[model samples]
Target: MITLTLQTIGGLMIAYAALRVHHRVYTEKSIDKKVVNEMRAEQIVGIAGALLLILGYLAAF
Candidate 1:
């Protein structure tokens, strides 16, 4: 139970950080678009990780 909670919290933090970085990129047009794309990809990964974390927690019971 504690492990699941930790994983969920960690995933949320990762997703939030990704959002912050993603937004920061918008303020700088000189940055590469590929970098922005990578940020978007990481956001997707964070979402998927959160889903897996939830499923694992449920399965553990």
Candidate 2:
């Protein structure tokens, strides 16, 4: 039960991070400090989310 919840939350976070990164890469005109920080943040989120998802899958089995 908890595993399922974790998987769902992780999936959502991954999706959000991917979207943010995509937007930052395509829409931004310049690589400013703020943009770089945001991209790094998004990458961290994506990595954490992926780890959560992998853990959830392992817990399921």
Candidate 3:
């Protein structure tokens, strides 16, 4: 049960990170310092989410 919850949350976070970049960053006309920073933060979130997903998968066994 805990593993399922973790996997779900992790998947959502990963999807949100990807969608945020596609919708917010992609629409920008130019790349600025702030946007770059936001992208970096999002990347971290995505990586964390990926880790959670892996952890959950391992826990299932």
Give the TM-score comparing model 2 with the true structure, all chains together: 0.54
TM accuracy, model 3: 0.54
Clashing pairs in 2: none
By TM-score, who's the top model here?
1
Task: Kindly state the number of residue pairs that clash in model 2.
Answer: 0
Which ranges of candidate 2 are over 4 A from the true structure? 1-30
- How large an RMSD does model 3 have? 4.0
lDDT of candidate model 2 versus the reference: 0.72
Estimate every model's Cα lDDT from 0 to 1. 0.73, 0.72, 0.71
TM-score for each prediction? Answer: 0.57, 0.54, 0.54
What residue pairs are clashing in model 1?
A: none
lDDT of 3 by residue, 1-61 (tens): 7768776776877677686775577456478777767777776777677777767676777
Instruction: Between candidates 1 and 2, name the one with more favorable TM-score.
Output: 1
Which is the leading candidate under lDDT? 1
- Candidate 2 structure quality by residue, lDDT tens digits, 1-61: 7768876786877677696765678467577778767777777777677777767677777
